[model samples]
Target: MAAPIDLELKKAFSELQVKMIDTQQKVKLADLQIDQLTRVQKHAKLTHTEITTLPDNTRLYEGVGRMFILQSKEEINNQLMDKQKTADEKIKELEQKKVYLERSVKEAEDNIREMLLSRRAQ
Candidate 1:
């Protein structure tokens, strides 16, 4: 009977360990996504500037030049905005996961403590 209870406790601890690892991985992925979004935003700004700086006399300049430039800028701005939104959402999710994982770890610790105390009492 004691052996079965010990085995069950060990399985529970093992499962918690796996969940902790998965939570850590999710946090790292979120951090990387945020970094990627920041870089993309910076690149989009630089590209928009380059496109705008083309002189009217330039051979590559096409019909409705100003309109084209504005459209391009708007597109880049929209992409950046989208990336930022995604990053923000990912970060929020990661924070929630971290909180939940922390709580789970704490609970596991409490369980272990209780088990030990019970053993000692016996």
Candidate 2:
């Protein structure tokens, strides 16, 4: 007893559901990336602050994938500054992605609602 338009609407709704799920997943992944980058940025800032308080000649061991290499205070400060900058950039990128995904999700939901309303009125 369903009209052709109803069937079409249902199909569209299903597709939207799939899209919404995918978008939600993307948002979640972006949020996780943002969180990770934020932590890295904070850690880098802390390291920079603490390292500056140390004597200039103090030796520091830089960790490289489970191994530590000897480095000077200036070298460590430079590395930390670079890391902080990279983390800031990545966090900004992920935040933008998250905002876009959120907007898409909202739009999809609105379209689904409209379709359902139209079908009901038919």
Candidate 3:
């Protein structure tokens, strides 16, 4: 009700707004990362399946910056497995981060609501 309390409440509300925005941005980034990792994992699995069905003498190529170089089937398979593993790990991490960010955003919203309610009750 007092001037100081009112000013403090407004400041706190503003700070929470900023925090919520930042957390939301992080959530969006994490979602994008999760989607990318999912795509990579799917591609890796598909490539691995294709590799298995290919003939022994089949030629394989690895593309690098506008160039394609010959690669052994075994080498490509290993690389694909490694890539899939990395993507899986990154996806897990991003999912956890997304959950945390969602929680943070919810808490901030709740705090903002409480502040508004208190201001109205005064």
Top candidate by TM-score = 2
User: How close to the true structure is residue 117 of candidate 1, measured as C-alpha lDDT?
Assistant: 78
Writing each residue's lDDT as its tens digit, candidate 3 over 6-118 gives 79787987898898788878888888889989999999999999998999799999999999999999999999999999999999888888888888778877887887788
Candidate 1: deviation at residue 100, Å? 1.3
lDDT of 1 at 32: 79
Evaluated at residue 111, the lDDT of candidate 2 is 84
**TM-score-based ranking:** 2, 3, 1
TM-score of each: 0.53, 0.85, 0.83
lDDT-better candidate, 1 vs 2: 2
- Off by more than 4 A, model 3: 109-122
Candidate 1 per-residue lDDT, tens place, 1-122, comes to 78877887788778768876876787677667667766766665675567557654444322364554333444544665675567567667766766777687778778877876786676
**Which 10 consecutive positions of candidate 1 have the poorest summed lDDT?**
56-65
Candidates' C-alpha lDDT: 0.65, 0.87, 0.89
**Which pairs clash inside model 1?**
none
Please give the distance, in angstroms, between residue 43's alpha carbon in candidate 2 and its true position after superposition.
1.4
